[model samples]
Every structure is written in structure tokens, then in C-alpha cells.
Target: MERTGTTRRRALIGAGAAVTAALSGCSSDEPGARRDAPPSVSAETLLRRRSAALSSALLGRYDAVLAAHPGLAPRLAPLRAQVALHVEALSPTGDRPRPASSPSSSSSSAGAAASPSPSSSASPSAAVPADAGAAVRELASAERSTAAAHTAALTGAPPEYARLLASVAAAGAVHVYLLTKGSR
Candidate 1:
């Protein structure tokens, strides 16, 4: 039997209401569920933390390079200072503490012992290259890698953090240039 227009309209309205009711019930009716949900950290906060960690690691590397080649202090000092600046910029509130000892202190001492003293003969067991050129190349490579990381991190960072990362990346690029120039 064919349905009347009024009957069809009524059925359609009833179906729509039923669907709406089903969807409405799908949400949690318990008030506790909303209240008990854990707070989430924002992506920007996480990115900032990661950038801060990267800056710290770079600072450690600078320390290692400096310790291994004390003679290069005059040149490397500025780069180390710049890395420290980056670390501070990345962590304006200083969330992470600086380590008491340099990351490569142990290796630096071992390398120092193996290399010739100012008044002694050179040895073969040096952990790092004895030449300043080699050290400069190593530092330049590290700076390039850091610059690339900062560039990649810019994608997810908040506006202020993005600008900071961009400035750091630019400084790192300049560092690489200066290091390369000095090595030649």
C-alpha cells in the first residue's frame, strides 16, 4: 500500500529525531569523565623543550672541542659563547640546569693525556685530531647540523619561538662560514 504525503513526512521527521537522539547519547553522560580528564601539554611547549635540549647538547660539544684544543681557545671562545647564548634564548626561563661538568670532560682528559704536552713529544693515541684545521672542520660540521635542526623545528614552533629558531639558524650558518674561513 502507498503511504500518504502526511504519513511519509511524519516518518521522515521521526527518523531524523531518532538519529539525533542516537548521536546525542553517544557522548559521555557522566560528569566525572570531563572533570577527571588529564590536562594536555601544548605542542609549542614540547617543541621549546626539545630546542632547549638541542642547545644544551651543542654547548656540551663546544666544551668538548675547547677542552681538546686549548690552543684554539681564542677562536673557539666566541662560538662557545654563542652556543651558550642560543641555549639561553631557547630557555628564557631557564627550565633546564647546566651540567656541573662538561659532557666530554672524561674524553677530553684522556685525549689531553694522550696528546703531547707543550714540552713533550707527540703520541699516537690522541682521541681528537691535533691540528686546528681538523677541529675547525668538526665544529663547522656540527654547526651546519644544528642549523638544519633549527630550520626543521621552525615548522611546528609558535610565532615567537619560530623567530628565535630562525635567528639561531642564521647565526649557526654564520658560524659555519667563519669556522670554514678560519680552517683554510
Candidate 2:
């Protein structure tokens, strides 16, 4: 049967519409339909987050040390500042709580509050050392361990994160050296 131009045009249009709908349905089922969406967090990002947490813990250690041995403040203050900087750099938002501004009040309060009692159980590391030398040595050891962790994490990090981790590791190394060899 012969078809009129109008009829042929209508049929062609309808067929095109059906094909377009089928293709659209197929594309909607694909995982890449939202290609513009932000990607989910990667393992590397999680690792960096853990690294940041480690940095935070190190800062906490510094605070504990200072609280325990205010006499070491003259020597350890600079190292503590460096560790704070590292925590800031490693954290994605740089929003970590800082040590209280009033060092004497904060340190004394932290010292008293954190002091171990016979009934209170806490991690040995959380306890402030009895002497300034011991505090320095403890911080030096912690710094070394943190730096080693950063170094190990670097192997699996992306290039940008690796650079950041390396810089943090270097800063930790410097703190370790100053803690061990610099006059306290």
C-alpha cells in the first residue's frame, strides 16, 4: 500500500520518539547517569583522615606533656607549636580545637584533671611524666612514631596527599630531633 507524505512523516516521527525513549530508559539505568556527581570518598581519603586523627592525638600528647611538666615549657613550647601546625595542616577543615589560650590555667587544669589516681585508670601515655626530662623523652618518642606512621602511609597515598604526608613526617622528625638534642 502507498503511503501519503503526511502519513510517512508521522510514522517516522513516532518511531524516532520511541527509539529516543528506549535509549533514555537504558541510560537512566546506567551507573554513570549521574556522571557530574561528586565521587564517593576513596580509601586514600580515609587513610588521610586517619592520619589527621593521629596528628590530633599527637597534639593531645603535647598538651598532656606541657600540663605535666610546665618547667619544660621553655624547651617544649616550640615543638608543641609545630605539632599544632601539623594538626592544622593534616586536618581537611583545619577546625580542630586548639589548646586553651591561657597556658597556665589550662595546663594546670589539664594536669590536675589528667593526673592518675589509684581508682582512676588511664593509658600510661595519658599520664604526665614526673620530670621534665621524662616528658621530653616521651614526646620525642611519640614524634618519632608518628613520623614513621606518616612515612608508611605515604606509600599508598595519592601524589598530593603523599607530599602533605611527607611534609608532616619531616616536621615530626624535626620535632623529634629538637626534643632529643636541644637543651631543655
Candidate 3:
């Protein structure tokens, strides 16, 4: 099936949104968990929780990218595995609530609230990009935003979280470079 620019964009954006929601929701893995629990956890604790969420979101991003570009399977297979590693590293500590985010983080992440495309279900065809460069830009934007969140999480989190953030930041940079080159 032929995918149009708009259709591809919708899918890409949709995938990004899904990842964001998954990451944000990680702090409350248990259903019906209270948003207003006692605030005794250290910044490190909060960071781990938030990082886990971010990790989950990034995984979703990879899933979306793969879905949009089946041809990328061979190239992206290892990257996808790396994202899984991120999730595993963050999983054990991904369920604590964080302090209220600063205004800047909130604004930067506002784009995360949008809806994805409705034209298609999640599948290999969904992975195909109508224009490789445009898809890369969309993916880059999501990675950039997630990386920013990692930076914020690092400021208030522990040294371990900082290390994780550093790694994630490096990955995001790599993703941006690859996407740009791929587009070209």
C-alpha cells in the first residue's frame, strides 16, 4: 500500500505520542495508584522512576520507527536491542512519583500530548516512511525531547541516573545523526 506524506507523518507522530505516554505513566504502574503519595523519596528515586518512564517511551519510539520503515530492520535491529537494554536497566526503579516538573520541562514536553494517525494499525506497513528525511525529522524531534527530559531528571537524580542520562543522551545524538544521514 502507498503511504502518503501526511499518513506517514501521522503514524510517526502517533508513535512518538504513544512512547511519551508510556514513559510518563511508568511512575504509576499499579492501576489506581494515587498521584499524591507522601513525598519522602530522594531526587535519585524520582529520577529513576522518571528515567524508567523515559526508557519505555524510547522503546515505543523504536517500535514506531521500525513499523514505519521495514527496510530499516537490518540496520536498526541492534538499535532496537539497545533500547530494550535501556528499558531493562530502568525497569526495577520505574514506579515512583516525581516532584512537580518545572515550567520549562512541561512546555518542552507539550508536544507529547498530541494524538497519532488513525489511518492504520501497528504493523510492518506502518513502519514504511513516505519520505525518509521527513520521518527522520519527526523521530529526531521526539528523541531530542526525551533527551531533554533525561537531562532534567539527572539534575535532581542520583549519580547512577546521571550515567544513564549520559548514555541516553549519547544515543539520542546518534539517532539524530543517523536519521539526518539516512534522509540524505
Best by lDDT: 2
TM-score, predicted candidate 3 vs. hidden true structure = 0.53
| Candidates 2 and 3, the one with greater lDDT | 2
Q: TM-score of each candidate? A: 0.67, 0.62, 0.53
Task: Between candidates 1 and 3, name the one with more favorable TM-score.
Answer: 1
lDDT of 2 by residue, 51-73 (tens): 87787677778777776767777
How does each model score on lDDT?
Answer: 0.69, 0.71, 0.59
Q: Judge candidate 2 at residue 61 and give its lDDT.
A: 80
lDDT of 1 by residue, 1-184 (tens): 9765678779899999999899877777755458567888777778877786676666666666676788887787777767766765676353644442455555333322222122121122323566867867877887899899999999988898899999999999999998898444
Q: Quote model 1's TM-score.
A: 0.67
Off by over 4 Å in 3: 1-42, 93-129, 182-184
What's the number of clashes in each of the models?
0, 0, 7
The TM-score of candidate 2 is 0.62
